[model samples]
Target chain A: MGKPTGFLEFHRELPANRTPSERVSDWEEIHVHVPTDTLKRQGARCMDCGTPYCHTGKLIGGMASGCPINNLIPDWNDLIFRGQWKEAAVRLHQTNNFPEFTGRVCPAPCEGSCTLGLNDDPVTIKSIECSIADHAFEEGWIVPDTPGTRTGKRVAVVGSGPAGLAAASQLNHAGHTVTVFERADRVGGLLMYGIPNMKLPKSMVERRVRLMANAGIRFVTGVEVGRDITAKSLLSDWDAVVLCCGAAQARDLAIEGRNLSGIHLAMEFLHANTKSLLDSSLADGAYISASGKSVVVIGGGDTGTDCVGTALRHRARNVTQLEILPKPPASRAPDNPWPQWPKVYKLDYGQEEAAALQGADPRAYSIQTKRFVGDESGQVREVHTIDIEWKKSPDGRMHIVELPGTERVFPAELVLLALGFVGPEKKGLVHELGLKLDERGNVVTDGEKMTSVAGVFAAGDMVRGQSLVVWAIHEGRKAARGVDRYLMYGQSYLP
Target chain B: MSDAIWTAGEVPHVLFVGDESGCRDELTAALGAGWAIQPANDGIHAMDLLKHPNRPASIVVVLDLSMPVLEGFGFEKARRADSELSHIPVVLVTSHAADERVKKFGARAYVKRPIVVGDLAAVVRELGEG
Candidate 1:
């Protein structure tokens, strides 16, 4: 409520993005920074409702309706309205461990739960959050906060993804000597490899990782917890060990011609592409080439969209995404009202690029692939598909029903499956520790986030299954708190 | 507060137990289905609506689970414990499909949200059948 008429005076405006033509040619982020003046006006648009729904963080309708980490939305909005940059950054960091990662990647459930969204467009909370973080970096407000005293306790974090990094950072803050072990050649797991340079530039990940290193947190890359080093040794050496290894066991499509040469998991395609791009500027001849090929990506989530964008960057001849469900409505449906995460159709960055290069959106809704038709040499060259409709069951549940006489095929040389992850791979460290997994294959933890074993804690995707980056950070922070309590006998300093 | 309550109708009631937009429109659609709609800003208000006799006899309590004051789960618990209100069936109207978790909370049926008025009416009629 900075300006009584602020919501009326200034309409919602997002910061400008680089033209698709300019951005798709290179591996850089699409968004351009908006000046402080525009941000202040956007901040003014926040009604600051008596009970701001933007930070409630409740799981409404199975999706997060607000900030998962519960960032103080109104406080930061007010700070921006009052021209408090450093204070805003500090407030932003109070709840969130890293807003930079979220600001760039999170789907912004906060905006969906905004009170103004009841009638008018919601305030640009995500943009404001990103601006605060970027401004903090530019002003040199972001620096290492090494603990003044030592706790004489050691913790080994199993993964170097957001969860592990956040846990390590928080544990370091509590004066516990912390070490992060990453299986990958570089520190970041999904952040470094799964996501492309266009969505989140590698420099940002490196910058944050470097800052954490400067803060006295030790990082050891290429040292896997179960293989390079034994889990028993890690458990014996460290006072407490927290497992943050993510759920990466991807869901696969089992069909005829599944053994074709061209079909690959979305992560494999994305990981190899990113590693090559980073290692030798794509001169290494390592990644699955989508160039001069008609690619059919078999999912419609963030990963599939990333594949589409990656293929476009590699100058693919054509690309199509097959979505099993029908296209979502352009506007929020009645059941998907405010504060319940509006399930409206939105064109993401990759979809936008595809639309710009091609004449239409690359997705085909209500379609299911039956088989992978291959060429003479066993390389996939075509995909067989059929249209479908949803039918209600006796239990009143909706199920996909294939339409009659709608079978068709597309010429596809490269096929990527982005059907999402099943759960954490229950192979290495998990088996070594004899960790108890839930029915869904995720590690089972108690109220204290500790596994069945004493002095061993678990967090993030390994425990909760595949989830968003924000949840990983939240779980990491929670796990850090649990680890601290176990070390200090119910007294903990982790926030 | 007065607009959210109406005592004149003989239609079966479906209490919308949340204050957000999804709750509002669902209740409004319930009214269109010839059912008396009771609006409670949160679970606390919902509990208040269920206790009084002047209110219509509610057949199904549609829950949003994301209310501010008293959560959807807590509200269902309080309802189940009460001798007078325990028998009333609940239809969980949420974005995600209702699953075993909803059944644990005493929900009889569910309508996946982004809800169509007709679909909700159909489910309510089916679940509300004698």
Candidate 2:
């Protein structure tokens, strides 16, 4: 519920972004602060549609159509419109463990299904949510809620990504002694490494981790559970264990010249860049630099976009992104209706920067990389490609048809493969714990998020495939409830 | 009653220039049955089609902005410099934001990609009729 006629009264407005030309030169966040008045107007755009789909958080057409964690969007919108900033933060934190993270990196599927978006632009829900969270922190409203009493139950959470952190925080709040184990030296896994600083600043992540620590949640970094201590010891030691180790097995492009030196996986590039940037402000000689080199990024998802953006910041001479599929339609097609995530073409932040600097969008669709050609010194010199057509066969399934005589080559000194991850690696933790895995190679769990082995639970990318931070948070909260009930005689108070 | 027979040169045609064949094929099918669609890989190939002596009675040229060789603006510049080709209307399609810079290219019409089929067809028809 919002101003009764807010939809008609105020148009949706978001904070302005720093110019692409300017942002590419620095690693600072791109968005500028929007005045309080402008944000309140944005909040007014939320409609009191009898059935709001923005909070449904369902999977429609195989993509998220709304807030995955079921954030009480309309309630917060009404609160913010009334200038109830403190109350808005309270409502936001009630559902979302970390609104700050989602605010920055989330694609805002909630806006996609917003009733106002049916005819006009949607409410600036993501920005409003982020602002409220940030305001709460600035006002000293957010602090460690150290539980009054501790339940002697000890819970060991493997990995320190969104999922692990959420589980550790919630379980700690429920009075369980929680210790999170992270392999990386830093506590925040993907937040610290997977995501670049330009998108979600590491400072914000460190601040949240500090708050979580203050809440009595113990974080152990540079110590991988299965590798350092062994999964057997973890199961025997802790009352309950939650495996939040993400699907880090990146899918590879196993073609010719795959072993070339210049070709690197997307995560290896992003992780090292962030690490070096934080360690010495990149003064240390580390990270895969794209400076003065022709960079070619393969794949066309958010990860690929991140690679493009990072390469630009490195001052790559030129960047080209290749996508195997055809570009999406400019508008939603018949099969993709509203309330379903709109599969339409968009110029993301990276592509926008690329277009601004290179004078054209860097992405080339309907093309497939045939091979990577190496030079005399065994460095990737060129990327061989050919045009492809997606045609429907007699079986009613689409297939790729390569066009002959359409061979082309893109000069490349640096190539980043952002093809995405396949599944959770089943080598160490899952293997040693004797936990069951699904066909997709993800750890299997029951409705309660309990794995095959008793006292062992899994969530996030470990159970689900690599997904958004919002979904990971949702899974983590659910698993906490499962762990709580198991320890509390079939009852849980950790919603 | 005499039946009217038509030759390839007599049929109305649209010179489709762009590297993405998917967009070209989708638009070809959407325009539905009146005109001939000539495919060109880039602005250079598009020029070859425009300069052909036996070219069809072409009414319009639809091209993608970010092409491999001779992009839409480059093609527009070359077309405007040539008197014979300058008369043909040009339409630009792009995935990026259509700003003042895109408008300044002097295209008769520009459509953002994930293109709206009906909207593009309507623009093409209006330009052809004029």
Model 2 has a DockQ score of: 0.00
Candidate 2 error regions (>4 Å): B1-130
Show where candidate 1 strays beyond 4 Å.
Answer: B1-130
lDDT per residue for candidate 2 within A385-446, as digits (tens), equals 99999999999999999999999999999999999899888888878888898999888999
Clashing pairs in 2: A329-B114, A330-B114
Docking class of 1: incorrect
Model 1 CA lDDT for position A13: 95
- The two-chain DockQ for each candidate, comma-separated, is 0.01, 0.00
What are the chain A TM-scores of the candidates, in order? 0.98, 0.99
Error of 1 at A179 (Å): 0.5
Give candidate 2's iRMS in Å, 1 decimal: 35.7
The residue pairs found clashing in candidate 1 are: A335-B114, A335-B115, A336-B114
Please give the C-alpha DockQ score of model 1.
0.01
The 10-residue segment of model 2 chain B with minimum total lDDT is B1-10
